[model samples]
Target: MPTLILIAGPNGAGKTTFASEILTTDLKGVRFINADEIARGLSPFDPASVAFKAGRILLRETAELIEAGTSFALESTISGRGHASTLRKAKAAGYRIVIHFLWLSSPQESIARVRSRVKKGGHFVPSEDIRRRYPRLLHNLVHHYLPLADLWFFWDAQGSPPVGLANSMTHAISDVDRFIHDR
Candidate 1:
């Protein structure tokens, strides 16, 4: 059995940081896939072309890995229909799916974080862009994507996970362990 964890959020919501922590700590030996990494060579200021290519590559590689029974975690903004479709495909492929959504306390917080990241010479998505898109992202997660998750958790970037999510994650990890052992 294989598992696919999809971490979704707006820019600067700390999705990558949380995904990396899970990969290094609880989910050692699992593959980590991120479209941002694939598109690293391109300027984030011009996102469309780079994101298109990265999405294509990520889908192809994810399909192959799922077919080969590899457990993986995928981190992405996941704000569009393309990403939603990819998650559907992963579910159809029989991989256990876990979804995590991360957000900041306010759009101001997200804007500040994006600016800080850009100042640090990291990949840049304009603070204005992040601000403009944050509400839509949050809306989509709450209204559409949240229902699709087998096990889901939401986190606040300024603080900790929403209450009981830590416990849910513990249970999900136990389930993942059982899935691996049963296979």
Candidate 2:
């Protein structure tokens, strides 16, 4: 069976870079998907938006890709109560594989890193309004529920990327290889 790996972390957790590294370094020929990318094209949902309709579409498409026996990685943020269905669908997908959840532990450090990345012209949340709203957002995501990841990769951009994430990615790739060979 092909593997389905979910790479999750807070904002600015280096999840995108980590996913890139995993695809190139460890799991070659695997398809990688990011939820943020999908969400970007989508119309913004209102607080009372009854349209879970698009969500089902997204989940079904993702499931079909997984069922096609293609190795894939999904990167997304699991913000509070809103993302429960998305998580449930991915969890229900028929892929017995490890979930390498790259959890960046420090919100303050992550915020700084995000600001720096935005300044450097990297893809990041817009700094204009986000900078003002970050405190509440961080408090909710970091202090509230749904912040935990299955496998933790504590990334601090203050220093060089840790070898630990590389090792973890290697282990995940090994697991995928085992799944392929076991068949």
lDDT of candidate 2 over 1-35, digit per residue (tens): 55666665566767788888878989888887665
List, residue by residue over 32-150, the lDDT tens digit for candidate 1: 88878878756455555588798788889888887787888888765565666666777788877788877565667777777888798766776677767776776666556655667
Candidate with maximal lDDT: 1
Q: Give all candidates' CA lDDT scores.
A: 0.71, 0.52
Q: What is the C-alpha local distance difference test score of candidate 1?
A: 0.71
Stretches of candidate 2 exceeding 4 Å from the true structure: 39-60, 81-93, 126-158, 163-183
Give the C-alpha miss distance for residue 14 in model 2, angstroms. 0.7
Per-prediction TM-score: 0.78, 0.57
How well does candidate 1 match the true structure in TM-score terms? 0.78
Clashing pairs in 1: none
Between which residue pairs do clashes occur in model 2? Answer: none
Q: Which stretches of candidate 1 lie over 4 Å from their true place?
A: 41-49, 160-183
